[model samples]
Target: MKTTIAVLGAGSWGSVLASVLVQNGHQVRLWTRHPQQAAELNNQHTNQHYMGDYQYPPQLQTLTNLAAVLKNAEVVLFTVPTPAIRSVAEQVVPILHAQKACPLIVHASKGLEQQTHLRISEILTATIPAPYRQEIVALSGPSHAEEVARKDITLITAASTSLAAAQQVQRLFMNNYFRVYTNTDLIGVELGAAFKNVIALGAGALHGLGYGDDAKAALMTRGLAEISRLGVALGAQPLTFIGLSGVGDLIVTCTSIHSRNWRAGNQLGQGKKLTAVIKDMGMVIEGIKTCQSAYELARAQNIDMPITEAIYHVLYEQADIKQEITALMQREGKSESY
Candidate 1:
């Protein structure tokens, strides 16, 4: 079953995903907003700015016209940033309507809409036409673009309310090196992906402050607890936190140097301002935005998420990171409860 897939976004994750699809014998056409990037990928088989020396599959193609690629694509994968999801979905609506085709919608983004606090799947459901809305699956895990590009063994979750939708994604990408697991817990998978980034920020900040290894471990552990609490409060399964999209993701994003969010937090811990860190990263550090949205969501739902609140204050309110840490430590202790 060779599928024609249209991958939206040419960032690190997007390009790598396109390459993997090409390797699986799918006709992959990457949609990039920048003409130069598309031209480079087509001509040199390398996206130096995003992928860095990783050779794209020779069969992969790049296109700037979204409608052209949507022409025959059986699957539309979104690897864009949270802020861009809405606009991109809006752009795809008429194209799908015009084509009279319904493709399996898969979103790999790991952030919520800042204003609406909606997950990527929810955003797409609201933005795209009803005809194209069957089951939007979320593909997420600890798998980073760099490691996946290197053909490292990676595991991820494909979650959707529709089991068929999830299995469709699993068969589309799973291989010897990449394993995909299907779960019907859409809320859990989506929240796990988004909230883990918030926790990863705190983890990176601790590392930047030269905290002890035990402190980092405690943060990661407690961070998982906080993520679980908030996620369950928001209608997600608690056990999902222990899965690849949850604990698995938190471990990699918090400790790996390849994580832009962790690197951004490291800069903040090293006494750099938020604006300066964002400017220097040259990439969208999703944790910063997810911190804001998740903080607001917790408050709105009366959910207790101390770590999320702490990172939000540090990133947006200019609160002293150490003071936030001290406050977190000084809070009334609870009996190791989630």
Candidate 2:
């Protein structure tokens, strides 16, 4: 069945998703804050700045007016960064309130709000009213926008408290090259999606510092342990960590050159300042902010996350990365299955 979809944001992921939805035979209106971006995407059918020469489907519409984009939309998919989700949701609230029927709300963003530490769905629920906020779903997994743009064989999980809602998203996004699975563990999916970015940052740092595969393998293995611990503490299912959003996302984000988070960490590992790295990347490295939120959450919950703690210090406290690694290595060892 065809759907009228409103895709928020014009970043690489957002643009690629809009293109995919167009390919899926949906009426996709991609909303961007900048008029120039909208005009370029609409007229040129390409987003060269972010997507790097990939041609978007000409059917994909780009718009600056939020109200216009939301008009008669059946699904509102937010592809904005975590920090911008609330602001965008606040804008969508009044428009949605005027509508007769509520659209299915879905988000591809993966990060916790800095202060509240809320997931994207929680932020949507808090900002959007009950009528418009029904059946919120999170679309996540080891998906890189560049690869997905090339029609790579990508598998992801669409998670929601409502199984039907998850299935709906699964149907909307699933294709021959892109597959979607439904998972009921919303908390686990969101946590796995967010926490893995932090781990990917660490993995990139390891690479930038010239650490071999053994070091990265150790970091990834133990990083999954840390993610699973905090995730379970926050009420996520244990098995979800090993699923697509958890281990799968972690591996791709940490290893792939397409990952902004991993690239940011690599720059940081090479002794560049965080500000410089972020500025140079020209994209949102979610792990930078997520590392802070996760660090605070872990500390408050009394969760033992040495890798997170180490990354947090390196990013925020101006601590020497080498020294932090030394401290981590010097800590008393314990059984792998604690």
Best by the lDDT measure: 2
Please give the range of 10 consecutive residues that has the lowest summed lDDT in model 1.
Answer: 126-135
Q: Alpha-carbon error at 87 in model 2, in Å?
A: 0.7
TM-scores of the models, in the order given: 0.98, 0.99
Q: On residues 19-107, what C-alpha lDDT tens digit does candidate 1 reach at each position?
A: 99999989999999999998999999999998889999879989999999788889999999999999999999988988888988999
Per-residue error for 263 in candidate 1, Å, reads 0.4
Show the lowest summed lDDT stretch of 10 residues, model 2: 94-103
Measured by TM-score, the strongest candidate is 2
The parts of candidate 2 lying over 4 Å away from their true place are none
Model 1 residue runs over 4 Å out of place are none
Q: Score each candidate by Cα lDDT.
A: 0.91, 0.93
Model 1, global lDDT: 0.91
TM-score of 2: 0.99
